[model samples]
Target: MRKSTASPAKRINFKPSVAKVIRERVDGKCSVPRCKNAIRGPAAKGTGSINLGVASHIYSAALGGPRGQGGMDNAFIASAENGLWCCQIHGSAIDKNAGEGYPPEQLFAWKALAEARASKLITDTPSPLGWVDAIQLLRFPHATTLPRLELSRCTLVAGVTASGQTSLLDLAGAVTQSAYAQRFIQREPSTSRVPFVEGRLTYATVDALDRSVDVQVLGDDIHRILEGKPCLLPPGDIQVIYTTLNDLQARPHEDDVAFLLRLLGVDRSALKAIANAIDLRLAPGPLRFRDGVEEDDHGVSHPRRTPSGERYVEAFCEIRTDELPAEVTLNGLSTSQQRGVILALLIAKAQQISQERLTLLIVEDLIVNFDSSKFMQLLAVLGEMPFQVLVAVPPARHNELLEECAGVATLKPNPDLSSWRLRWLGAPIQDSSPSVRRSGVQGSRAPIAKLL
Candidate 1:
């Protein structure tokens, strides 16, 4: 009863059209409907890359597939429509389940059923309120060049926790490290909220960008709302929009002032002007806190200081950057005010501000004690130029001032980035230092080795 177990040479999939749509839709993830996870080669887990995702046939070759198993023929491409992309583990499990001895339908049904159940849990049914679970990342040895294995979608899990709670990710379609991050940003709850809606997307409104936006939802705008909040951000359900993909080259932490300013289209000379605005003398304190909306003959308004002592100032007008000091604090100004100042300084640096370049500014944590009206005035200037403003904060107060200050952009914890999955680490090296604690550590101190 010996059956041939031959190796199939790798096949090339040449469907750029389907791949293109898939790239834009899922942005480099497994194409299974609603599957937003990426695909990583097996090298991420010490496995060879050849053992990665399978462009599996939704229909088997034995069931009239053009080619039998173990063939390099493109006929078995199965087409993107009929293709199922999955990581090596799931791919192997799929092959194992379809063996003559197993009930392929039963095993496959569990995954489908789980996805449908998750969808239903959000709409038709309710998950138990008391059931709580925590999920963490999985680590691997660092010596190997594994691509970073992970579940493609949060809707299903690739791994589980110690308590036996099944992960909600489809571990079957683990993806590469970089692609995983992109997919998460594009489709996670932050970008798409409604579980039932397939093609629905969320974006901010014009008034949300400017203070003029009527507070139809919460009886005020970003400026008014942030004025009352403790965290200086709006309440629930706020989000940010990434209209452009500028500066993806910068590391998340190393994103510098120059990069942000460049994106704003600031001119070199104007940038110098704003950079020179840091004044420590005339307004030795934060930009003099100005209460009234009045501007001098030239349009520059003085600073404002509230009764409780927070500082605020107006940035709605342009001024000579060369005359501005190096450090001027604008009292009573909201977070939107701060962000707007930085953004405008950059934008003014540009010789030409393109209409297409304008985007809403989303702010988090503006629902605190910021003055909503002043915030609105600032947003009004930006909005007149047809830009947006979004803000986010914790589930607390300061809404009145904050709502008027900035748009809303809620942050979602990314599974791949936040997972903290361990990677290979060489054995720890022993330290040569004696157990004794040294005095004047790192500064005005003697070298311990010399003392020894």
Candidate 2:
């Protein structure tokens, strides 16, 4: 005798609005945690939307459908409460094998999980611009270690060449880029020698959605870390501006200047402020900064040597007054004057962007060429901006810069020649040696013995 098969039960249709409500609850993402694919997109050629998702039923719509649980009343069968929004693939898979793979309990759990994620995303949207509260280092490259760094209005990172000051700042930027730091640690735990075994990075939200983002990185891969969640900074909400040695030229590259201005969102008011600051600083000097152009030309243009054998660009911005020539060339300016002009430009650029996003201005020894007074002026201007500032400088200027800063950290080479040790300068100091607790906790701790 042949095995008997039950005939297909009467098919129940879903109300038009029921599918919309179910999709809205899950933010139009597939309900399955591992397969949160976007199922709807703009129509191929028409104005109407196209939906590739299926509002699958946790309890089947028909008596013979997956997990249909025969003999239930038909009215409640196709209601919104029974729907699970998922991509067509997962939806079809669930309905096959008589729902053996995905039972009613499992499908309902996915629905709940998807709704929770959607709720968090909707409620926790970041403000237009938020401040960077702090940068916590759960892990870093090499042997030296650091504690949770509390940021302030201004921070001075003092270190000798190759002492890892720039590396720390780079790591901070990486972590802010969509959980890359977390993924790095998850892949290479042996590279980090820090106390926090479960690498975590926490940042606060300004609109008070949550106090911080507590990200656990260890013992889990990138996929597990996400677990159907989003990044803390979202996309393009935070900007990290890094001015390296290449950007600190006396006469900055035209392309670099234009890029900086665009990032800084410069305007006439900002240019005026920069000019005023430079003019005030250069008092008693013959030269005064009035205004500068966006660049020498519409796009990238090289400097030309004049008949007098002076390298000049076509007034790429200006540094002129009534007594001075109509056009000023960068080659004609003195070192101090050029430094002043560059610092002013940078400050003006930084101030303009702070209002639009959580901006971080990272300057690597840009003021190393400045005199004490000019350096102080640059620090003052940077501190006034609404963004966090990280300045990396050599140890010689540590005393000059630390007095006015909110916090300071020093990176010094170790005697053993293995790695650079990092020390936080909690207070202004007369002697750098006194601030480093060599014989304290750092001395007693051994190198990383194992990877978790």
Candidate 3:
């Protein structure tokens, strides 16, 4: 068992004031009254200084929306018009529910909401899809590929192909198409015809690479698209949604796509209730083993014995999409682990986050020195959260932490036990009368509702 740390996250209600992130994106408090428009530097922030502004979820907190987010469309970046320019204190307060919705008149409302916002109940209004901030971008580090719009049943959705082609408006440009063609037609333009595209949002294909990026515009046709499905999918099923944290973080290969899917538990749907978190590989170095052995790369014999036997954990730092450096330091862990953690949290609460209702998180193989018991306790406390938590083993060994989990699943070979698969639940074991006994335990009766 690795030495577990006593650190635990204080129970916090994920605030709805948290806005989405976009490239140089920021929600603008209208400098003009009733004009309902504004602008700012960017949605993403730099480490060196401060970008002072208020972040408002396009979907209000009162509307059962996720904290630190706006709406289904604006999940990745906050809009310039979606927020106001309040100082940090007010931003924090409103972020912490110390403020009320839709720009209130006084500070008193903020204080009350801070203290009572979690308890204060308000019904959400059916907002017309007019706000520019109400539009959803595909995902962070926006894709330059043409987007695919789905006009399904109720909501119109837009995103690029996994390979970055075919946009929503491109498919929906003709609203007067034949019904069969509208249902499942392949769009092919005739040699001499160019149909006029009408949409509240517009996108252009800039490149074929995963890093290919383009500017997006919001329009009324796009709004109508937003109000209706983009003919993206057939009727009657949940959708599994995914977005790249950073297209350049890794190769734009199917392996990367697979990882993203597994992380979200919806590798193939429009909606998922879980997501995989990332492990930061800020720099590259040798892989280490807990048993004083370096992986693949062998170490030289000491002329004199060193005091510390060996180091096992890889060194890392947390980062977001834009923060990744061109060169990395490690092999196994290779992206923005911090943002992966954040996205995982959001995934566990997708309905809330996507619809803007709640926030949740999970992290796998987080290498830490905290003791197993202490760590398990913290995980338990976190599991009680309104959202969800599913942390993986922090990439260590000895199975000390694994055995201490609230739930454990091991897949050892039935005959020889030569190979096995083990999973950890991150919480302390709950004492149940029907304790699991291994295959070798003499006279133990088999028990199963289904061993899954």
Which candidate should be chosen as best, given TM-score against the real structure?
2
Q: Supply candidate 3's per-residue lDDT for 268.
A: 36
Which candidate leads the pack in lDDT? 2
Task: State the lDDT of candidate 2 residue by residue for 353-415, as single tens digits.
Answer: 666656667665455567766665565666555666766544445553333222333332323
Q: How high is the lDDT of residue 187 in model 2?
A: 38
Candidate 1: stretches off by over 4 Å: 1-51, 59-80, 94-238, 241-305, 308-324, 331-452
Positional deviation of 72 in candidate 2, in angstroms? Answer: 39
Q: What TM-score, over all chains together, does every model reach?
A: 0.23, 0.41, 0.19
- The C-alpha stretches of model 2 lying farther than 4 A from their native spots are 1-130, 159-163, 173-202, 209-234, 248-326, 331-339, 399-452
Per-residue lDDT for 55-152 in model 1, tens only?
A: 44433434333323333234534344334444445445445544433233432333343334344344323121110011122211121211222211
Ten residues in sequence with the least summed lDDT for candidate 2: 443-452
Per residue, candidate 3 scores C-alpha lDDT tens digits across 131-186 of 11111124212233222322111121111112211122222222211121132222
Ordered from best to worst TM-score, the candidate numbers read 2, 1, 3
Count of clashing residue pairs in every prediction: 118, 3, 83
In model 3, the runs with Cα more than 4 Å from the true position are 1-254, 266-355, 363-452
